[model samples]
Target: MTLAVPPTVPDPSVRSAIERLRQEFPELGPAPIVLVVRTCREELRGSPDGALPELVERLARQRLRVSLD
Candidate 1:
């Protein structure tokens, strides 16, 4: 028997949100994945290719909220 793994589908909401953010802030490069789960408030994951401080500030300004565990 072969076990099939389901393909990952990108969330529409997250894509839309990222698009909007990009439109607003083009300097942010690319928006990290933002997950809004029921249990948690909001989570931002993935690393941006750039300076750590700049990335942090950019994400903050874009309002991409995230919580670490």
Candidate 2:
């Protein structure tokens, strides 16, 4: 008999970070928000789990804000 494995779900903080960035930079719209979040997450992929959410949020915010300037 074989058992099935479930797909890995991303942490909620990732979504939260994305949404917060979207709200903070509405002018950039959904596509840019998603891009920034994904980029930030990738940059911190090796980071400690406990710190990822806040790190992702901060990095994404900075990147998006810089884009606006």
Candidate 3:
């Protein structure tokens, strides 16, 4: 599951992730799928500015099947 971006900066990559999941789980049908994105304050260790986009880009760099189509 991919994290939903903040209102100010939407992430287009999420749609690819959703499409990936759908292909893997065709039985899902039209039911709603929800996966909340969360990172504990401690885990962040006071992340730098623009952390969300940074993290998202870093994740994309890993070549996660989030999109290789």
Instruction: Report the C-alpha lDDT of model 3 over 1-69, residue by residue, as the tens digit.
Output: 334333344444434444544555455432322132121212333566456444533443333333333
Per-candidate local distance difference test: 0.37, 0.76, 0.37
Q: At residue 25, what lDDT does model 3 achieve?
A: 45
TM-score of each model, paired residue for residue = 0.36, 0.81, 0.32
Number of clashes in model 1?
0
Q: Which stretches of candidate 3 lie over 4 Å from their true place?
A: 1-10, 34-69
Kindly indicate the candidate among 2 and 3 with the higher TM-score: 2
What tens-digit string does per-residue lDDT give for candidate 1 at 15-59?
A: 444555556555546623222210011222344333433443444
Model 3 lDDT-worst window of ten: 33-42
Of the candidates shown, which would achieve the greatest lDDT relative to the real structure?
Answer: 2
Residue 64 in candidate 1, Cα distance off native in Å: 5.0
Candidate 2 Cα errors over 4 Å, as ranges: 1-8
Alpha carbon lDDT of residue 39, candidate 2?
71
